[model samples]
Target: MPVIKLTSNTTLHYQEMNRGAAETIVLIHGMMSNLSVFYFNIAPMLAQRYHVVLYDLKGHGLSSKCTWGYHLQGMAADLIQLLDALHLRQVHVAGYSYGALIALQTAVSYPERIQQLVAIEAPDPFEQQTLARIDAYSKSALLEQIAAAGKAQGKPMSKRQLERNYNLYHFLLKQTTLQQDMLAEKDFMQQPGIDRLLHNTLLLYGTDSPCASTGKQLLRKIPNAQLAWLAGDHHIPVQQPFQVGSSINSFLQPRENRIHHFQPSATSIGVETPGWNLAM
Candidate 1:
């Protein structure tokens, strides 16, 4: 891992592969995650051609958490400062879930720093549907039970304590608020610059994913956009890394005078053969 100092004494942690290459791809992880999440899923596939950079978000994983707030815009600004310190002017960017949202802010704040953008399972800032979805999942019976059990045992739960806390229904619904800031919406919606940069982006989500509708909605709003639905819900890139890599590689390939099939059809999303089946 490499370290880049941000404002204050705080430093950002990141890793890079194939440094000398024609193009670079910076992979940003979502909330509650670190750079390692992308290693098994995306790095191997992208390392040969593009210089791949992966990093921890400000307060997540191995990075320092000295910031005053958990605002996404602050995170985006941190990334801009990172690129400046590294002398990297522009690069291809891809982010998953919360990371995707931050990537959107990055694109808006510094449009010249992005060559292409890919957002997977990223939702709009303040849509009713998004709010409703978050509220529904947050207050679900299963999660409520889990919280209760965790409370009954103690705050800091052990592995066995957690395993016993889970109900059958809990297994079916994935946990969405593991380490997310509930206050993120306030910071996200207050900003106006993000929408302008979304037009030149590619949106993706899994077919079986509950968040697929958000991806579709984004596609409708963005001009050079397409929605790709992968086979697995919420974990396509993790489960089917090679296939996800192939799809992105094909999409990001540069075009000459001919307008090569740039637009993705319905079939191009998540039609790949099932690879690993990891339960998230």
Candidate 2:
């Protein structure tokens, strides 16, 4: 329920934990979802050793709603501004789904302000199936999707939860420019700087996820990156939160210790964090 107004006058609701820790991490939830995705399991586990901030993206969850600024460029800027307003210098960032793309964009645009990157199930926007859900938005479909997502997490959506989620969905699909802006991100993965990003990065994807291909693409695109497959599909994080949280924790450990844990696949090459300093 915590809220912050960025310099742009856009307000965002966020959750924070372990504020007194030495290091800070920000978790961003994907489209149509809020901070609660990480709030339940991921944030708590990461907070034991690091300060954690999980915030709903603009136009989602209790955040300010705007018809514009749904593009990655704007979303990334909003994230940086959120950090600035919170007085956080540089911090680790982890995002899921579309949120993952925003994290990459932020790191690409403001490399000096990022300590590490964690991208979970970041799909290629160019994929037709990726945007089909957006283009084919329907109120009933949204409700079914939310209900299924909740069911995947081992709890069916209650009537109130279903109504609340549907309202957010209707607003985003009907009142906001989310789909159009997302469509504009088709070239995101091919950006010239991708192959050049040297941050210590971790890529998590469901083994069976169609997005695994995009993860491989990122593994090849990012210099110091590695991909780890969990046993699930695109809903992997919610399907397997403990595994996801454990992987993130192990990856954030010291480089030497972390390196051995990530056994590489043939396509997942050159995984090392030589460009980042551990002292941070």
Candidate 3:
């Protein structure tokens, strides 16, 4: 596994593909999920046309665990630091579920550092159901949920995988501030500047997903955002990876072509590299 140590002294696990492609696209997975969400199917499709980057968030996957910094702002800051470490000035960003919220926060805070944005199945932070679920999370509940998810997908959970997942859950729930940090941002979408976001954005939601309403809310807020409905629910990325990948690829292709034909203008967002510092 590849690791990059952030300025905060935390190390993150990441993977890259098609490094020499015309443009770079960064993929962020949702809460309790890792970059593996993209690594298998989506990244490969995008890599055919763009440089694709994927990383595990702090305390998730192979990344170093910490007790704080699970909030959106902090998560976005971590991403910025990672970009700085990788020498990438600006790149397209795509995120799912909680990761989508982080992507929105990043665009709002550092509009210049993002070329375009894709938000998939991002629930509204203010939703009561979202808060209630976090409040109810527990080690036993997590294991059962994972097992049920596996059964639904026709992949029965193995003892080894279950044990590994249990360990991860125990550490994150008992040792870290993830739940509290997430709860603190319950009103994030209603905050100032969210509705004013100006990036060319794509909002993807599953037709049957409860989060579809949130996608609609975002479409009304973001100036240039377009919403598209997929076939499944919150797990659309896993259930329909090829379709998701193709949609994003088509949405991003025109911009990538334009970059090759013209030099970025002085007015371009993030054209002037800005110094970044740890948000802690």
Candidate 4:
């Protein structure tokens, strides 16, 4: 029930659990999901080692809805302001699906405010063939399946037909959004004033997931990025949280020392202190 007010009169509902060092870890959920999805998965494992922040994005959860567009920039800005209100200067970020796209934007848009970023299965520029496959997903039949599942909400996707229907719907939504979002992407990714702010980023993908290649590609683009693969599908963090958690913890343990490069500013509270000097 906790909520924070942003500058544009948008109210975002969030949950916070304090742990670890002063550093904060923020979790952003995907399209059609609330922060609760991560609650059963990533949050608990991370809470033991990092101050955790999970919040609802506009329109998706208890957060305020925009009268206009649900653009990624707006979402990223909302996160930035949320940090300001919480008195957190910088944070380590992890996001999935649409949230992953937003996380990527956050790193680019406000590079200085992000210390470590992990984008799990977000999309990238695709080939023409990829677009063709995406287009097929937007058919009316798929959208109807999605709408039905959205309405049903936990009535048990116990049947194969039911699960297939839900997956179809998810595909439709992503396809619809990709078409509109891609147009703005070129300009957004190449803003002149934006710096190639570098961070030690982690890119994750599921071996059986469609997004795996994009994860690998992202690692190539980001100089400091590292890549990892889990065994399941797109929802690996959900289906195999423990496995994902183990990988994340192991990766971070060795790199803990590098997190202290930046000084805390008004926009970066709960950031890693420069001189903790821990031997992990």
Candidate 5:
């Protein structure tokens, strides 16, 4: 695993592909999820046209674990630091669920560092039901959650994978301040600068997702934002990776005379179609 030690004394595990491509796209996974969420499908698809970057957020996946800085502002700062460390001055950024919030925060805080923004299934942090669920987490519930997620992907997780999931859940829930940190950001959407976000933003949400409304809210708030509905619920990325990738690719594609320009030649895009595997 490739690791980069940040100024905060934390090491983050990350993967970079198609580094020679002109534009770079950074992928941030949701809370409790890792970079693998995009590693198998979306990342490879995007890598066809742009350099792709994915990293495990602090206390998630293979990254260093810490008890603080799980809030949106801190998380966004971490992303900015990562981009600086990689010498990437500006890049497109996409994030799913909690990661989506981080991406939005990053764009708000450091607009110059982000070219375009893609937010998928980002929930409003002030939602009572969502906060209730996070406050209810426990080891047993975490295991059941992992099992259900595996089933959703049409694959039963291996014992080893279950053990890893269990450990990760236990550490984040018991040893870290993740839940409280997130709860503190409840009014993030109501903050002053959200309406002024000037980036050409793409909001992707599932038609049936509870958070779909948030996408609409964001579209209304951000002057240059647009929303696209997908087929599945909150797990749209996992259920419809190709659709997700194609939408993002089209959105990020350069424009000519206000017309979308896509690389139609498969030979140039070099699309990868590997065997599908689920990682929770």
Candidate 6:
């Protein structure tokens, strides 16, 4: 229920844990999802080592709804506004899916305000499937897609969950500019300067995710990045929260030479160098 009024005249709901830490990590959720994605599992884990911040993005979760500013630039700007309002000059940040794109954009736009970077299951915006989904977005289509995905995993969603999801999906798809903003960002990954992100970066992707190729692309783009694969596909966080949370904790561990390796064969690129550590 805690919220902050952003400079944009919107109120963003956020939660903070492990106050008074020397450093902070901001968690951003993907399109249509909210801070709860991390509140239960990931935030608590990171709070053990660093102050953690999780907030609902504009028009999602408990955040005040808006019809504008869905582009990556606007999204990154919202993040900066949140940071400034909280008086945080810099933070470590992690985001999933489209949220990851916003994190990458933030790093590119506000390098001094960032420390380490973590990207989980960030899809390449240019993927045809990604565009198709945006162009074909509909509440019913989303329900069907979610149902199909749920069925594939042999887990049927309850009626209450479906209703909740539908309300959010309907607003984002049929009632806002989000889809257009998303389609406009199809070339985001191809933009210059993204290849030059200087933060010690962690790229976490699902071993079986179609977006693994994008993770590989990011690994190649960021000079000081390491890639680790988790067990699930796009839903890695929900499917393997403990593994995901622990991996993030180990990466953010302050002590030098402290590293943890994921299950064998799940990692693609991991190396140790002077003054930096890699999550294997």
lDDT of 6 by residue, 1-280 (tens): 8888877798999899997999999999877778888999888988988999999999989999998889999999999998998889999999987889889999999999999898888888787688554334334335555677788996666778779877887787889888788888888888886978898787888877778888888877888777877766777777677778877777776646564432223333343333354554
Q: What is the C-alpha RMSD of each candidate to the true structure, in Å?
A: 8.8, 5.6, 9.1, 9.2, 7.5, 4.5
Winning candidate number (lDDT) = 5
Judged by lDDT against the true structure, how good is candidate 5? Answer: 0.81
For all candidates in order, the CA lDDT equals 0.66, 0.80, 0.80, 0.65, 0.81, 0.80
How do the residues 1-280 of candidate 1 rate in per-residue lDDT, one tens digit apiece? 5788888567889888889888988888865446766887687678878999888876565677553444566778888888888779998888987788878778877888998888877866566455455445334423544566678985544567445334312422233332244345645634556445543566667778787766765655555665666677665556556766766676677766225434343344532112312122
- Candidate 5's residue-wise lDDT over 166-250, tens digit each? 7887788778888888888889999877999998888888777778778878978987776777777777777778888887888
Model 1 clash count equals 2
Candidate 2, residue 141: the lDDT equals: 40
Q: Is candidate 2 or candidate 5 better by lDDT?
A: 5
Cα lDDT tens digits for candidate 4, 64-173: 65443456787789899889988889998888866887888888888888988877767553444333433342243245445656678935334785565455445434
- Candidate 1, residue 228: CA error in Å? 1.1
List pairs with backbone clashes in candidate 2: none
Per-candidate TM-score against the hidden true structure? 0.73, 0.85, 0.84, 0.71, 0.85, 0.85
Q: After superposition, how far is residue 33 of candidate 2 from its true place, in Å?
A: 0.1
Where does candidate 6 stray beyond 4 Å? 131-158, 259-280
* True lDDT of residue 206, candidate 4: 72
Error of 4 at 130 (Å): 8.1
